[model samples]
Target: MTTSAALTVRVVTSLEEFKGLACEWERLLRTVPGHSFFVTWEWLYYWAKHYLRGNQLKILFVFDDRKRLIGIAPFYLRMTSVYGLISVRELRLLGSETVCSSYLDFIVNEQHKPAVLRGLYEYLFGEARKTWDVLTLSELAAESSTLDLWNELFDEAGKVGEVVGTSCCPVIRLPGDVDTYHAGLGRNRRYTLQRKTKCLQRAGRMEYARITSPREIDAAFESLVSLHQRRWGTRANGGVFADDVSRRFHREVVQVLSERGRVSLDLLTLDGRPIAAIYGFVYGETYYFYLPGFDPTAVPKASPGLLLLHHRIEQAIREGMTTVDLLQGAQPYKLEWSTGRQSLVTVRYYNRHARAVALKLGEGVKQAIKILVR
Candidate 1:
């Protein structure tokens, strides 16, 4: 909303301006057909507050002639070394590998794609060309139209981009009812799911609940982490709670999002004792499975983890969520449950500078060596 020109793109650097755009941002995000919760101000604002060390926020906004906000790009600038060899000034997305934001895309009104893309490029590569040497974005869904836009723009600009890594994100399409969803699954899988549900039933009263109350947030999150640790032991910490920073971000962000009715921390209990849990975010009628944890000591016959997933699905369907994004993984379980797989990719676009070319080449060589080794 803070801008000097009528038809120009604006760079939002101050936290005040970021906060001011909350209403418009959410409105624009909803206008977009397919978007993720990561683009939400609440999610990226806290991310910046916590893990944006040594980096400068460079969020971009594009407005129409009527001063209507149309597009938004959450970006940051930092100096990074490629494999600790070549140092390059990088302009990257708000979320990175460390943050585990499974998916990302700009919140752009489809009508203004051209203007937004052009204005953004002019700002980054023309007005402030020297500010950055390379542009990197990761975990973009392969089918994401944003990827296509970038590819088209970079192609038009005669710049070569590289695909550094790719992962499969499977998602389940929710049905009108849980029974219909179960019926849609393969007969074998349906039987397994039914058996698991019955097994849990035999273990006294089974209960499924979502934790959203402010008072219950802390205890629920602790139970989530504790059960996660118990299930994976040290591996849990390594995977999700890899460091104190990630832990701190989740602890605070979950509470913040839950307050807004955006978080869905599904908890499953067997006879009043927590057995399995999954951390999810509900945004725009889509459920994102961010993390999951279960008590490993639970009865194997019940398959507490799978049962929790089933319960979560039932809840999502009843709540009218259109899809359940399993994030990034090709696990057999995910494969069985997913209606289809979305490919997430990492992209790097180097400017026409010596350091940029060197860094790109160096990364290509490293990736090639890794492939060879594999």
Candidate 2:
């Protein structure tokens, strides 16, 4: 049966083909409800160029009858291990996991999302005949509209899927100004901010600035990454800057996004020295609290990192932002300031292949061991 006669699918198999979708990619982002700079071509392409490292890339596109793009599934197949098994072709979303591209999904234009998803699945299982052992999609918001739509589609097909909870993303619904925002905060956060601000002011000359110029981006972002590494220092399974590849990838993305006004790399300076920084991004009316760093030597009273966070929240409100996404972490600070939460899940689908069967069995055995231990 024709999945959707009005829609046609295209598979991009190489880097050159992927680059050609730049114009169409930007146009499609404008048609979606959830605005995220991390998912944009600027971010994804840079990530692919640096981090992909010879993985086979498979990009699927869904177009309407007029050949206008309606959806994009930027995916790649890579080798992974399961239960001592090696060389498994796992399909996953582009710019996912290692890049920390929050809220990843198929970029489906809302107007034709249903048809696009259905068309995409048809292409995956039908015409293309993908022999992928398992498909893994991660960092999708718990409330993701795409998750809901595809879940329904998969359920109808009687396919078994697994959704593992990953992270808790807290969000704040802004109310115009700093004063109002402070009023809505929990007592602890309210007092913490007030006390910390006074201490920070007394400490030295504190200056908070958001840099967006391409000329200034490189230097400022480099400093931000440095602070982040120093503060983390081989903790939390190693910071994002632990690997040189991720650092370079971010440098490229920041430079591009800063020019387009999609990024706000905030640096908080004290006594003419950089003490803290926050990597922030904007898409539509939403502000993403992407990454952060602070001087380890700074006193707790100054709360340099906390202060920058507070300032950015206020700045976002003043900018007329409707929501502040704290990205994919559930730290106590995020809980204190956040009024709501979003969960990211990993959806794994298996094919009727030897590799897939081995993975499913490995998972079953692993689950049994975990249960026995508990």
Maximum-TM-score candidate: 2
Please write out the lDDT profile of model 2 over residues 1-374, one tens digit for every residue. 23555677777878877887899898888888765666788887887888788787888887788777788888988888776655677899988858667888888866787788888777776766555877888888777778888878777876656785487789998997778887777788688778988887888888998888999998899889888988996697578888888877888888888878998899999887889999988888999999999988886667799889888988999999989999887888899778888778878866556666666666686633332233
Global local distance difference test of model 1: 0.80
lDDT accuracy of residue 128 in candidate 2: 60
Each prediction's Cα lDDT score? 0.80, 0.81
TM-score of 1: 0.89
**Candidate 1, residue 329: lDDT:** 77
- Rate residue 123 of model 1 by lDDT: 74
What candidate 2 gets wrong by more than 4 Å, as runs, is: 1-6, 186-189, 365-374
